[model samples]
Target: MADFPDAAPLATKLRNTLIQYYNIEENAWRIAKKTKDTTVWRKPSEEFCGYLYKTQGIVEDVTNRIVDHIRPGPYRLDWDSLMTSMDIVDEFEENCCVMRYTTAGQLWNIIAPREFVDFSYTTDHEEGLLSCGISLDYGEVGHNFVRGFNHPCGWFCIPLKDNPRHSLLTGFIQTDLRGMLPQSAVDTAMASTLTTFYSDLRKALKA
Candidate 1:
């Protein structure tokens, strides 16, 4: 666990904090949402948004292991770090680019360089130094919706109660933004890509 850099300690810290926060189930994300230190309690959308943002690769690692543990492959465990700035799911304001935070009667737009939006975050990978522009596809993050195959129950996409014809993605969402763009551009462009990712995931699942 110690060998995996931020993975071990963060998970441990997250686990403990969650217990104190929810005082219910010890699921991974419920804890994070409670401890976020944001003034307004974060919505589930925001918490998963942030988790998929930070631990972009962890899901695929767990997924691949689950698959490799079940089905072998020359498999690539995908991870993504892009954040969904906001969601206006109702009919009137769908797919609008909402900022990640709304405070002091304003939406906080996370200003960032184009490259950071494309590749890597200056705050994260570069450790406060300016990156020299790595690869072309550095920060372009992706989200996916795959059908379940012989896995757990309770996660199937059940259509909402009011709208039985339309379905809800009860399964989960995952992202993989590594090598998608430049590390420096990650800050500015996360929102649009996130919107696109959500749209794409919904479409993919519906198909």
Candidate 2:
């Protein structure tokens, strides 16, 4: 593990988030969508849970390739339609960066463009497993974007023993999309977002 001495507080926060990510139980999640090689699940919470959404997914991909695509700050806009721009605001370690992401609004809806800052850390632990943790920076806010809160996300890639070229890509995200949008609409949008993101990533890897 790399030392982040200058940003010790942020490193501690990231470590805590990683611990929570690992503690999430599979049984607590309900299936939202499933395909031949991909499965997405959601964990419903009470109104006071401080989290509006919690989603998880597992998909097949090449471990290194997927990690490379996801860990880069600028590559996200290529595959994530919701993200219009991403800028690296700071760097603590070689594999850890703080980024600001601007999201596009749904044209027909009341939701406007929002921005969020997150501290992201990536580690290639062991031979074939890549792990990353992202925690929202509640203090950072842009002029035209809403400051995101209570959102902590994680990504992991585990290479398959049966096939060296293949891996299982796992991700978890808990976000509070602050707005008056119906829960049903939010659910649909979240599901579609992940589906489309993975599809685009796969296509990009092939290209």
Winning candidate number (lDDT):
2
lDDT measured at residue 132 in model 2 versus the true structure, 0 to 100: 51
Candidate 1 segments whose C-alpha is farther than 4 A from its true place = 4-159, 164-185
Local distance difference test, candidate 2: 0.64
List of clashing residue pairs for candidate 2: none
Poorest lDDT segment (10 consecutive residues) of candidate 1: 97-106
Candidate with top TM-score is 2
TM-scores of all predicted structures? 0.23, 0.79
Question: For residues 11-121, what per-residue lDDT tens digits would candidate 2 score against the true structure?
Answer: 666556655655677677777776555666877544334332333334456787778777755566787667888888778778787776877875355567777766777
lDDT by residue (45-158, candidate 1, tens digit) is 332222222111111112212222111112211211232222211111211111111111101323321121111111111111111111122122323311111101111222
Task: Score each candidate by Cα lDDT.
Answer: 0.23, 0.64
